[model samples]
Target: MSRKPSNIVYAAADKVPLGTLISLGVQHASLALLFVVYPLVAATEAGLSFEDTQILITSCVIFMGLATILECWPRFGSGLLLVQIPNTSHLPLAVQSLAAGGPALYAVMSLIAALSQLSLTFFTGALRKLFPPEVCGVAVTMLGVALAEPALRRMFGLADQGGAAMDLRYPMVSFAALVVIVVLAIFSRGPLRLFAVAIGTGVGWGLAHYVGLTHGPTGRALADLPLIDLPQLGWPGLAFSWAMLPAAILTGVISAVDMISTVVSMQRMDDADWHRADMNQAARAIRPNTVADMGAAVTGGFASASSSAAIGVAFATGTTAWRVGVVSGVIVVLAAFSPRLIAALSVIPDPVVGAILVYSSAFLVVAGMELILSRRLSDRRIFTVGLAVMAGLAVAILPELVDATPDWAHPILGSPLSVSTGVAIALNLLFRIGIRQEASVPVTTDDNPFEATTTFLEHQGDIWGARRDVISSAIPVVAEAAEMLLDTGVAEDGVVLRARFDENDLDVTLLYRGAPIEIPTLRPSPEDLLGDAAAVARFVGYMLSKRADRLLLGRLGERQTLTLRFEH
Candidate 1:
């Protein structure tokens, strides 16, 4: 039998929802390792001491792990169920910042970014109201447009010595791979479609290998590594550099905006109600993330980028609880302890990962676009929303325009896309022509609908509010009685007692005990004893507690006072 639900439950405990969490953990670990390995490779080729390379590697791994932990297990008041990873989106900019001023630039940027994420939390409520469906849709769609360049690079090849790919032929390879993936995704059923990214990447990898174009180094040195230990936490030496402060702050702001968008998107996707309990759950989840984000920024790992993957995992897995988060944290810890296992999996190559990212992000873009399109916008409003979205994309993809801006202005303009969103939304509101008015409709009641409802509430003797349906049938009677009592002037001194039901038994008396009262009646009535106002109140209280739908009320003997019996 189906029981009436008080609240909507999005997920139930049934499936292995932990699969996506585990997959995301593994994927993040793989990405972070590349951050470490890529730098090490660069240093080695540049004739830097192996000791320096090892230190860099250790620093990156430790900080990345710590950041992951912080994001998953926050310590603050609100726990956002999200994780912080190195922002692959800022790879080019980060590298540039690093080369310009070394570790100082990186540390400074991260610190600013951490502060930005925290600050963004305050505006979350306002943001929800402003973006709604339309603005978010366009902004998210434009985000994908901005990301196209890097994705293309991954599919083809990194720049050659002359600043081009080893060959331009791989664009065709990448496009072909994308086509196959899209076709399978569109036609395949269930799990096959969901895992299309992985399958497509595998196929793409095979083609690359067969064509003798996948000429990357082969090594098995990082096998059989251990999988558990204490986390290393420390500050970066260049953290205090004033010169890098601006960059750090800029990065922080961008990260915070991205994090906000991610969480909001997840909330919508999972259809989270954002109730008190859900908010509390989110707060609990965000504690570790705070630490992780700050740690990664300070320690020169990846630029901190937060995402609501834990919540997404819960929704996807059909489990709306934190147990899965704990499981994900454990998996990450195990991977941190086991380096060789990660190295073995790293054989998938950068292009494959890039392909997967492109596919997923494309879906996000489309989702965002659909949201914006769903809004009722006039032609002028559409142009405004569209221009704002495009402007955001321009700012996000091209940061050089911001370089010339003043120090304080960086925060205002650093995250070109987010800043654009804010500006465009504000401007759109300012340019609005007029406010639309809504007409009110009146409802008529033949009998006072709230008449019995008032008596029911009076009998229960509770204060404040009650549900509409509980009073639905009784309201008319109670309202009529109230009007009659007012007209006759009997209500000035005496009180009316209302019983919920007319069942013959001692159950009604047992539920509400009160002093018996005798009264002269003007006309014939049913029942012998007249229950007092207190008795009526008790019956109503019982009904309210049990969430009863209907209530019964009538006069005792000839007495004007009524008894109430609530039906559950």
Candidate 2:
């Protein structure tokens, strides 16, 4: 008899359970509302008429949909099935860029951003090593850190002036919405929890409407809109500013990183790894975003990308497939087609969006924090890494402190996600290699650092050395072992230790004393099995828990290798 198809295969075939897809649809609708609301507000500030704003907003949603689709389905079998939405990263810079060079300049910059993103995608493998989870966690942390001010500003009711006169600033609306979302997410079981953001926004909207706070758009504003028109798309006429390059590059790089990170994180969430995933199929996932985003930027629309929020929808409902994503995209497309509907949704107060944003941003930060802390690092190493992260956050928030510095320095320094990560990596390397202790002394028991050395030595004489076996079984443990050996002088002699993981198992090299070693041992251990479930529940939950450390911690952290040579 044929075996029943597994859920994994079903998910890959785009067979998400219907209830889950609908729930995600609501989220896409709310996100689409923001696409209109925020962009219109920004465009109004840029001196565009209501009609122009409508044209731009409509065009942008379409652009976003295109990007979303491309990211999900690749024409050439290589897409990253990640959701891309209008990048919040560009909001601050877009305002500045618009203020300095008009919408035209911003559009020109969009082209540059797209070009850069495409280039990065083409060379993603090379860039992959540069952005490990630690680095990505830092970048994501900084993104939210930079966004805090804008969120606060929206929380304070700065964005609304004349259109859709709802005072989103009302504490009742904001706080009520926030409470609803929080309570639902924390307590509500199953699909209800997934709709927390959407429910909160809707509740806030209804409350605002009941309070007689908002008036429907009338007269001049109503007449100003074009019922149906093709979105304008072309190369922007704005002059290229050299100073703008860095900003564009920053935006582009962050966008690409965000897409890749979200994809990887989602896969982990779905218990899907790179090997199991159809790389060609996965790469095709982001094709929609590329086309839509590029078109949106050229047509005076703000760029958007997909959300990893799909992972939440999938995890909550126990489904993982492009169908959910496609459903979300379809909702966005439907909303985009109806300008009136778009306008009505766009009328949602900043506080509502602000409240949702605050929650989402906080969630993002928590995720980042969890990712950073999940890794096994020494206490001193953690502190060093933590300092870099905080420094980057501070730089992002109080940029004026570095006002004397060039604009180019801001992206590099203020971004805790990048700079601190770079620092943390450097520090990790230094701590592992620079620290020193007795070479011959081995830590035989788990009681002290020397115990690790003793343990390694105890197994060294066996046909299958512990280091070799353990290293082959788990790559991360190699770092732990090498640090121990290098510190104790065992690895200093530059010997290649060999060990068999099991009887008749092929011998494998687990570590190289002096160089970055690549030991290809692919097998799942108990920790690996547990790690998948834990990372999905909360990227850092079980990984960082003190209890998990005993089993998770490798033998290498405390062990040492003694290299002795005498004339033959």
Candidate 3:
């Protein structure tokens, strides 16, 4: 059986009609607007004037556009559809830094952090060896868990009031918005699905207004807003202090991990053939964007990273075309110039924003879990991830724990993500000291499976005295078959490829503990290639048959085995 391409229209390339492009662009713009809350929250916590907050929003939007443009560019980006925004993951740190020494300190720290990220691009290959999926996954999941409390506070409208009694209407509005978003996400189709967040927020805002709960800028304030204004340009003040170094380093590390995770997820969503993160592509994509983050901070905005909301919008609308991103970037830049528009958007109720945050944070937690489980769940991995997450939770939820930490270590210890990530990285490395030397290298989502398989096969061929031509052809045959199985979602976690070489032949086997999958025949008609998902599977079968001397698929109770042989 063969499989057909997805029915979702304009899911890739520039195939979308102009009208549809504009519509999706508008939808993306709306999703981008949702991120404005981060800057607003930062401003409120810092007690900045409305004018300064507006300026921050404008600069953030502009830089977000710039980062999006860079991300869409093939040379600098992963070449997948992605949108960048001020990272909410950095909000807690930003608030603390801002309160400690105002926006100047925040800007300086952000700039340093961005520079560190840029420096990291040069050593991504090394970092990849150190930070596997399990470690990174724990860190990301901890971040989401840590952020949930803040989201809840905003949802209950307790953020600004400082524990001064809860507003009953706030939870009502927030829960209503969350329900609407959930319903739309699960039931709506086409463009309506893409605008789920916007629609939900609008509903919540309308309800709050009806209940006379709207507290931010309103009709009079909006009316007084200028129709057009440019963000003021200035250089951020810089300070060289060792006390802030740990915080900056932690920020850089988290940003890099988040960006990599987002890019890998985007790739998996866009291409069915995706198996692992292309570390080279990820580094290329993140380097320039880190530069853009530096530009944003220097220009009076917070640091930015890839946006999960925009990714959700693309998935919901099936609008993964790069052109859509370009259009959205243009729209963002246009919106940045309109103070009235900014003012109108600024009035979005805190609860509405909190609902979106909660929604995205939930996904982040799920994604982190998936990443951790995508490989073999060894005892070491379990302990590493579990302890890191539990430690992070204790630090994040207990103010007394953070309060007891030294003032110099406050920035790093106060952040649960930082604490967990640092712990996970340290534990992962410590555990790897003597136990890492094994005959067979593990294949996980953190590893480039194709490259690793090829290298493994070549080494085996040399020991077995297999012909160069046989080894060369066998590599792709094995790689493609494994990729096909992964693409069809046949593998529960992932496939492990191992090669056994003897005096007369080389044998390769792919082991997976997943659901039963039918193996297609070696040959298929032209129609099979274009028919459906099953047809795609058949095409892979055909490719594998042609490349190997013998191909066999078998099952043993629970385990499935795919074998390929090459006679010397």
The candidate scoring highest on TM-score is 3
- The lDDT of model 1 is 0.46
lDDT of 3 by residue, 59-136 (tens): 788888888877876766666677877777567667777677766777888887888777877886676655566765
Error of 2 at 106 (Å): 3.3
Task: Please give the lDDT score at residue 339 for candidate 3.
Answer: 71
lDDT of 3 at 3: 22
Ranking by TM-score: 3, 2, 1
What's the ranking of the predictions by lDDT, best on top? Answer: 3, 2, 1
lDDT accuracy of residue 11 in candidate 3: 54
lDDT tens digits by residue: candidate 1, 342-365: 455555554654565466467567
Ten residues in a row with the worst lDDT in model 3? 1-10
TM-score of each: 0.59, 0.66, 0.72
| lDDT (C-alpha, whole model) for all candidates | 0.46, 0.53, 0.71
Model 1 TM-score (2 dp): 0.59
Better of 1 and 3 by TM-score: 3
The alpha-carbon deviation from the true structure for residue 158 of candidate 2, after best TM-score superposition, in angstroms, is: 6.9
- Write down the TM-score for model 2: 0.66
